[model samples]
Target chain A: MTTIKVNGEVNIQPNLAEFEFKEVLSSDPSRKAVFLLLNNKTTGKAAILVADKNPFVEDGSVINEWIKDAKLRNLAQNDIYGSYELLMPEKFNAVKSSLIYPATDKHILKYRRREVYMIYETADDYKSITKPSIKESLFNLDWVYNFLDHKAETDRIVFDDPDPNIGFMLAPDLKWNGVDVDNLYLQAIVVRRDIMSVRELTGEHIPLLENVRKQVRRVVKEKYGLNPNQIKMYFHYQPSYPHLHIHVINIKYEAPGAGMTCIFLDEAIDNLKIWPDFYQRATLPFVGKEGDVLLNKFREAKRLNEE
Target chain B: MTTIKVNGEVNIQPNLAEFEFKEVLSSDPSRKAVFLLLNNKTTGKAAILVADKNPFVEDGSVINEWIKDAKLRNLAQNDIYGSYELLMPEKFNAVKSSLIYPATDKHILKYRRREVYMIYETADDYKSITKPSIKESLFNLDWVYNFLDHKAETDRIVFDDPDPNIGFMLAPDLKWNGVDVDNLYLQAIVVRRDIMSVRELTGEHIPLLENVRKQVRRVVKEKYGLNPNQIKMYFHYQPSYPHLHIHVINIKYEAPGAGMTCIFLDEAIDNLKIWPDFYQRATLPFVGKEGDVLLNKFREAKRLNEE
Candidate 1:
């Protein structure tokens, strides 16, 4: 096995004994990667190394070779796809290494199982369909409150504005691996608890929206060297949580759940400026995933047709 | 070389000489794939074959072997990235096959070169920045008129409505290669020439939007067997061309240029129905690519900050 050291440490052919084991920064089971922070004892400097398993080639010869050499322990089997832990002999090593089989696609679509339905939500539909669903979910705000109070993810917070009405705390999203700057993704959760979603926003909240947008851009520029033009800010209509938040992502990174329910922050502010009751009076279209409570409610109300 | 035959023709070991070349369905140079229609003389039936070059394994040995044996003919070199034609010896054959080098990424992003800027275009900005740029470009409509007149893509038309006020012609988008139903993408080009973009849309055009939306859904359902819930319909705020069109795509397919500038057709109709001059009164936010005239105008007018 080759000992590869990245981040300015030379001696690519150094023996594995020369390096001291450190801590694992992160591990992604789906991608079969373990990011390690190692110290090169010879150089007395820290080196970052990504121990990632190579993907199988699509060639028949490669597949046959893999099948011949692999000892698989089945994890699960459902229909056409199956999951397993493959223990295989390394190229120049006697020891077998274990890797998860049925490796996830590189460009993973998180909502592949979820079918998106565009629901034309009226104010009445909000009352009958969305509002009740939100109430039923009874989303606890303790975690959010903890984060705002500096009891959670304190070290991860990039920017924190304490002005209750127009303030938000920006932090790196859990989806990001924290290594790749190209795929930089962040989320800014509003400090105000009153506004649950974009549906509740009016011209009165334009300052909050603008503040988040401006501060996010400035902080990203200062910290990450990414220009304002190289970043995108948008709010999800049917967000994972009902709490009002804005997603900030590098323009180069194609974030999942971007197009379906995403509404640009600038567009939202512009609309509110034109008509203070724009979101209140307008018929908003949102994507509802399969088996969602709100989706069922929409179907029951005849707002969305039964499939 | 193994002559693999697909599409239920059996006899995977058939000689290459036994198959008669009919025609090429599509050839993607970037992906090094040639979709060919072949006739199996032995079976007396047509067969589809995709002759694609396998992607390189990220292993050091594989890359070293590739570099040692492959012959390259340079196409172009710009900075770090270069394009080439690779002629390499086949595994078991004396014949050398040709393939384009620097194979494009499978999930190809179209706007890598173009920087996306969120330009806030007010009514005045539209007149000063957008209108002049459109006028300056003088986008020729002869081809569009020709298509409308049945001089082009007549066979490709999936749905056609003749009402000039509320009519549109639906056809497969150029981006989608016709074979893959999972990636089914279509465009509905409006018949009326007066309405140029979403900016020009008003409450009066609600009927037209609804008609297009309804007929498109019906046609996709009838012809493609795609449920209304299985497809997404949207309009690009800053469309490729000035002429009005709505993009219809399979909800499963992550279409390029989707997340950016895409507004739901349902939302547009709902907005128009509620506010007679919703689009007219709203300040629009759109993405502007590098070197775009409107982008330059926006920069000059201070609508978008200079980067």
Candidate 2:
């Protein structure tokens, strides 16, 4: 819409030329996360403003940022947890958007921010920062495509042919020790068939997990050409993948996150038998490394106190 | 210690004749359910006055219940769901000498009991009510005795013989169908050798659950004289037993709690392989019939919304 002023002074109404659009991304009923993409016209920079809807929208601090891209709909993450990318590049014209009167209708702009996921440093480098999960961001994972793109995730897989029910794969992980280590197969992962990750599991999904030892043994004996007795499986608490996966390793090799960190799948199944929502109900205890943003998220949520 | 007064205005101040004792029941760093056995000299009725340290020592709420024969710690449930047997025999005096207070100091006690477990009803009725597991009332199971008692629980076992790792047995249970059903072996249970129940399990206990299918197959072949595929194993959520047992029933039988209510043992093991605290973490969701004390506890805690 265009408006012209009768006097020499140009009169611009609030909604004039203020275009906006909205889309539901990775939604599943409630949300796993919600975010905003804001481009500054003055500094010529953008930020993937991921947060609980409270901060991103209602709290108005995000509104205070004077971000003009709120109406632009073409921005998306390079991948889950990766920095955002805007498809149509443009120089924003919202420098006056925050200063415009009628208060709530206008944004309060701030430039030069820190501690956020910034992508325009360059296009190719996708730095990942997991979006905080909120009611609006419940992720509806596109598993079929993941199976297509990362399906070669099965490349490191051995022995048994891959089935949608299960996948036995060598993790793109470091060896617990040097190549000189005795047990090379000591670190591998097993993924769930029907669901993406552990968080999605209900008691109903437990059966798919049953008899894990025998199934793994079949894979070990048939696929790896190894003795079934030597293999053991493990699932680390607060695992790295967003998917529900298991690690199968040689019993002889002592790997990191082993022993107590390792929960026998059988025990987990039995526990679920007694309490189906065990994963959801259990207060997870985990250690954070130096640059762990997850720990920061936990600290922000008061789930864990920061040191 | 005894307080003697000659005239009517007797000086029975503070610790004149206060008597007290302590009992250590299921205890950890923060809690131990302690109680006093008191006897009403006039009524000749006894009660197990149970409460926390304060109610037992300083406050006299627990002492007022007047229980008899507390050293007769041999009290047990008429049924696992019923009350303790302290009511059966009723002549008690403070047997233990704590030497703390003067001896039976004062009675600032009133008795109008709205909540308690009572057992005088009968024994043939095996009412099944799970206990509410508050932090103060965590179970301390006695396993060695269950082994001694239920060790022969393995004798009725058919189709499968006991392995050091796995043990199988037929339970003395009624058919799922009323009087019409046959094939009782469809409801057999497999008990783990080491731990009492799922709560005691850690990663180390997992191997005992491994190759369960193979063991089950061996049983189906040898003990049942049937094909391996005919049998299936189920572990009910919030099962009544203190021991870790798996139900190895015929797969064709449509037992109650089968699909979602029951967790397949195999799935349990697999889940544990990922996160060991599966059972401990899962919030148990169950329906309790009226008169079930545990549900009453949940109601008290507001875990489930009131009807």
Q: Say which candidate scores most in TM-score.
A: 1
Off by over 4 Å in 1: A1-112, B1-112
lDDT of 2 by residue, A3-77 (tens): 334245454322211221121111110111222223333333332222211101112233223222212121221
TM-score of 1: 0.67
Determine the TM-score of chain B of model 1.
0.64
Global CA lDDT computed for model 2: 0.36
> lDDT per residue, candidate 2, B17-84, as tens digits?
12222222111111111233333343333322222211111112222222111211121112111111
Model 2 — TM-score against the truth?
0.28
Chain A TM-score for each of the predictions: 0.64, 0.43
Cα RMSD, each candidate: 15.7, 28.9
Tell me each candidate's TM-score. 0.67, 0.28
After superposing all C-alphas onto the true structure, candidate 2 shows an RMSD in angstroms of: 28.9
Q: What are the iRMS values of all candidates?
A: 17.3, 35.3
* Candidate closest to the true structure, highest lDDT: 1
